[model samples]
Target: MTFQSSSKPQAFAPLSAESMAGGVYGWLTPYLIALAKQNAHIHSRLLHLTRTELHFIALCLALMGEKRDDADHFGAFARDYDRLPRRSLLANYIDTAGPGYSPKLATLVSKLAGRPWRMRSYLRLGELYAEPHARKTLCHLASISRWHLIALSRLPAPYRTYGVLRKIRKRYDLACVMFGIEVVRRVRTDMTDRQIIASLERSDTSRIRDWVEAHYERLPFPTAPTGALTDGTGAVSRPVATARDLFRAAREFDNCVDRYLWEALTGRSCFYRCDNGQRRIAVAELKRLPGVGWAVDEIRGPNNAELSGPERAQVFAMFREAGVLPAPQALSRFSWFDLE
Candidate 1:
């Protein structure tokens, strides 16, 4: 194809609606504006990342796409991490952002090292951010920047607008949050699962408040051993405030154990990195949650340290005979539908 400065503007093939279940021009158009501002090297670097790396980048794009810049919801999503959409909607968007269809994912990520994003570009970014792959990997180096918008938005101050209000200087709109489904999560660091779960199981649970406050992770006893509180990272138990809190603890414990095992055995978590840091775990990990009493990992692997060689075979056989592990009656006592 040949072009001249005077040539009439062109329209690429219209974004396919099926391919666009993730949102089309709403995502790509803004990215083009972002791409225009980048220097070549950075752009090329992002363009050259691996397929997995490319998916991570697109996750960022989908995330940053929903930012609210208009006077109404300006800066509202700041610090808002848990607002992921339903699993089905996000899967659709991933299909949209995934490489087989949207070739621009690489291009957009390559520019991350160079460009600054505008708020409007985020409308679709919100939907993409809700995508599960994006949610699962939100802790990746590529994914982390999108979350850092809380700190970055601090720059374009006055940070004021219509509909939304700034809180402690963060863009916080009451209206958007009224219907916002974002699930605000707690960020826990360090401390391994055996460490966390052991802590929880050992602690006193007489007081409901105190019971929830126990630490479940047990920090790998340092091979050389650090006297660091014997709690590994010095994070002792703290009070759990909601059902989500217990659930989060259970989830993290499961993830830490599974991830540690996977790395020791397979060198990776299901599809992402074992240490991908948000360190999100599968729900099955909740089975042996000490007090929780469910056994989800009925899938069984060759080497489970918690279980010896013979024990592994036995437990898995039992798991197969039992089929899927069931959540405890106590777990049912709490409504997952409502955290309160």
Candidate 2:
């Protein structure tokens, strides 16, 4: 249940939680601040949780998590999340995304915040709403293929943010998703070398649009999650993740996402429950490497509002058969907004 470097493990450098912590240390503040300014209002209105908020919340949750390594060792510093409270003031607007979109979005956001795609779509939803000269990031997403959306939608959780991001960005020549330049960090969990290779293959971007079209309806919604259902539970409250927070996480992701990672070997999903397990890369050092991957423009996956369920299903089938999904682990579930 550790990374052993796939083909050329040594070809690429190593990374770990401890090392990565230091890697992003000095950068977190400025990135978070800038993203906050960019997404201030939109993160307030979206139907999903913002990725930044999700990342911090996930960080908090991870800190309070069961595993020591995953715990928020940053302590009080971590608890002092200004972004969380700033967004709380914005929760009043999440119910304002029109009528139908608002209610369903409310359900979707809560569900996303609770579990499953708490990071991916929520972040996507925020990003879609934030574009300086853009519209329908969802449109782009929808065009991608429902299967890709569905797969990305159904990621498992303790609501891990980075774990999920790496899953999508590392697969299928992900160089095209970013606009110009980006930093990509692919974290491997308990995945064996074979599993890592398979994950990379399953999420090839070449067929991403096709995958999204197929599984449009299969997205995780507020209807079902293996854990707690989002029936107004305090544990899954409508916590507003501020635009600043969401923006920050996205930027950091942008920074790491753009970095070109040849092939990284790590655990399944890069989420390790065992702190005392094997030591792979020096996460801090790895974070510092000249990590710049690809950054494509446009949005394509879900939110297309164009395809039908049957069309989506067919694409889903094709992706499973063809093996180019964002999240192969999500096949068991159909709803993206399912509970935590």
Candidate 3:
């Protein structure tokens, strides 16, 4: 669509409701005035603009702002703006800004305008434009829904890295990405890139409980050879030798023991189910500290509730007789919720 110049002068006329119907044109007046000062022809061109042409002009202003350095080039573009087609205008406007200009913004704006205009997405584009990796990130923004764009833009600054963007681009599953964000943000921040990707890939359900259960399937079974830590008087403690066993223990005891699968697989810690004559009593974690040979890190009853006085005394006495020392203040009670 081409905008034609009219003989009747409506220059400096008040903006009507029809001219600013979608609210997208509200921010363009200030920018247009700023640009008209640099080029006198822009002031005359605004006199005969239709609403459609006004939308196009708003898009152009959004793409190439009224920067002081590019006044000459911007004036040249403004002089010929009425004759250019919609596609040509977008292409030429981005081209005039050189290689650093991200085409993603234009793509997103065009898509937003195709239907009803989304003011939130337009505002979010402005916020994202200031980021260092905005060029790379905007490439993916063109394909996502407006709601997804808003959700992604609201993520924590640390989670807005290129790697995370690549993950979002590849999967295009905002729910899975959100689940991964929660795990890394609240559960474990030290998770590696590969680990985070794996977690995201394994997510099949959006529910937190189901997601945590599915995560257990990715952990490898304990491979290092270790014996059971047992005591006399029918109170025996046996090492959880497999991932399945740990999962089962977590389900039966209603605790988060499965989160320690990484530590167990790496041989840094070992979990044992303490039982008395085939009846489970408590769960224990034995951590191997650098200088301390073997220390009883934690011993908790079902649901992570504390054991009774006698039960605690019995467990401690068993560890003492078995040459296992009590964990020091610095090393005791390691929780997966603690940041690495």
Report the lDDT tens digits of candidate 3 across residue range 10-61. 2343334454343334546544554454345665565455545555456565
For TM-score, candidate 2 versus 3, the one ahead is 3
TM-score of each: 0.17, 0.16, 0.47
The TM-score measured for candidate 3 stands at 0.47
Tens-place lDDT digits, model 2, residues 1-340: 1122222111112224454333222223222322222343322432344544544443322222222122223222223334455344234223233222211222223223232232234434443334321222223332332233343334322112232234455444243332111111122233354453343345544443332222222222221101211222111111112223222323433323212111111110111000012311111101111133111111112221222444334333432332223232132233242211
Candidate 2 lDDT at 150 equals 40
Going through the candidates in order, what is the number of backbone clashes in each?
A: 25, 77, 0
Question: Against the true structure, candidate 2 has what lDDT?
Answer: 0.27
199-232 per-residue lDDT for model 1 (tens digits): 3334443332233222222222112111111123
Give the C-alpha lDDT of model 3: 0.59
lDDT of each: 0.30, 0.27, 0.59
Model 1, stretches more than 4 Å misplaced?
1-176, 180-307, 325-340
**Candidate 3 — which pairs collide?**
none
